[model samples]
Target: MDRRIFIKNTSLATAALALPKIDPLRSANLAKNNLPKWKGFNLLDFFSPNPKPVSKPTTEDHFRWMRDWGFDFVRIPIAYPYYLSIDRTKNITSEDVYKINPEAVDRIDSLVSMAHKYNMHVSLNLHRAPGYCVNAGFNEPYNLWKDNEAQKAFNFHWAMWAKRYKNVSSKKISFDLLNEPSMREDMNDQLSKRSAVPGEIYRKVAKAAAEAIRKENPRHLVIADGNNVGSTVIPEIIDLNIAQSCRGYNPGIISHYKAPWANKDPDHLPEPKWPGQVGNQYLSRAMLEEYYKPWIELTKKGVGVHCGECGAWNKTPHDVFIAWFSDVLSILSANNIGFALWNFVGDFGVIDSGRADVAYEDWQGHKLDRKLLNLLMKQ
Candidate 1:
């Protein structure tokens, strides 16, 4: 079935899921337990995946907490660089990992197994992907499509993953082809124009990965995110066929508000909002409508879309953060799409990296308010 046409014909509900927690656009069939019956989610790597565990990430502990939080799924961002080698600009020579580092491989397996133990849906994404990602700092010297070697290598990696996870069913796991693919090099120069380039590349890599996945796994949902990494940037790709994920944070605005690149960074202008405010840093319901309208349209057209990752800066007030999350989660719930917070805990992690309850509000564990969890758990 042609993805374009197939998407064109499906009712919007089957396509993208949203929250805002009103009457769901789609029917909310209660499970045997009669819960809200939404597709649940959690943002993975609450703290950065420390190559050195006990010292960095509290691996097993976080997973246990996720399960305890009642989240139904988890999305893990995995980068291949740990296994592959590129030159100074970090340009991937073959797109394939030259070494497939043992540590990286072990962590990947461990995360997957951890999710399985809890019966949570696991989404594997290629973050800071070899060829391209939003992190220009990490991109070194790579460009999508322009590098044939990278493209081929990317294809090979997907093929490898498809085969590797062939046995991992969607019931327990899924795969996001790549994190955020900038269509062109000058995304910040002129987002309006740069957005379109990624569509073709995404289709190429995503379809290749999907085909590879379907050939083996058969049921794992293959999701693809829109350009700008967020639904707001490119309205055109919103209705695209692949499953969708978006990076909703405003660069240096909220989560990255203070990031050094926000100013000099060409990708985005720094206009961060302060926390504990309603209209500024937090995304409101109307804001969600504007930001996610494209995703809604795509779902209307028949693609499985979801708000994969959305959260504010850890420095923000917990109450303010909760309000923002409340609003965003409500919007996602209304639509039935999955939502994962930026992290469960850590530097950029949900917990103070891995100290568990040791830190201040920064620690993911201490910061987790049961009230918030209960509210989110409500169908």
Candidate 2:
């Protein structure tokens, strides 16, 4: 079915409650030295590293629907290999990383243009960068946190993107340097033990990339994802003046209950419950507040903070997902920190999520989670 026709036929009555207006004084303050609290979702058109069959292009209906629903931001998470000319059969080399594919880049350009056409802010993020990816499948030739060659290639890619969009206003677009920077023992093992990159190493890499980006356009805004896979804030690069991105998947037991990538044994895990005991630990809104205290405190120090990726897998019960997510959203919104859900569609989205428990609303042939959509819009 044509998504355009479907969107046109969908009802807007459920979205009538407009998003709360930004406080003028707070807006001015954040505009002066921090990032705006721009709320929206992540679009995964280029999320996969192997681009044999490119992901479906996001249509105009996406942008139109987002704007009409009161969302003003979209984070485009790209796997660097998706845009490079490389062999899928072999490990990616530093030389292969430098190979620029114009056709692949053109596809990205179209998405960015379409996003801006709807007045939505675009944040370009490298979910899979040159030398590292949090959840691994492809083999990386070198470690981004430790190898000079990998760092050089990383800067090279950021510089190329900076130069490409140098003419675009910082207000309309920003660069999220890398997604979920962390250290893992093996690049190709998804189950490898992972830990936070040392502060000095993360700082050095971020500083160099920020310099490369600014070398093209000093006004280009740059953002760095939180350390330890976006769960903790990075104090090391605060002085560099780069905004920081945080994650919303706290208490992984709740967010990734039956997900294979997050859990080694999805079938045997305890069922998730909000404000109740899951396994042995007690979870509640107070726990969530305490979890985000450091993040809120970081903002008080004048650092721009945003939740880059967040949401529960479809396997989580709908009631539990909504109940827990409500506390998550309420806390962030209260602190004036905006968030972008992990996705706009698919297993972790507000539309066509394929959750067996949800009484899905049919919107233009798409299964719309009106409950989830209403919750997001009210924020």
* Candidate achieving the largest TM-score: 2
Clashes of 2: 0
Total clashing pairs for each candidate:
43, 0
> Best candidate, lDDT-wise?
2
Q: What is candidate 1's lDDT per residue for 157-257, written digit by digit as tens? A: 66677777777666676777777666655522422334545446555656666776676756666777666555443444334335666554633344553
TM-score of each: 0.71, 0.91
Q: Give the alpha-carbon lDDT of every model.
A: 0.56, 0.89
Writing each residue's lDDT as its tens digit, candidate 2 over 184-271 gives 8887776789889999999999999999999999999999999998989899998998999988899999999889998888899987
RMSD of each: 11.1, 10.8
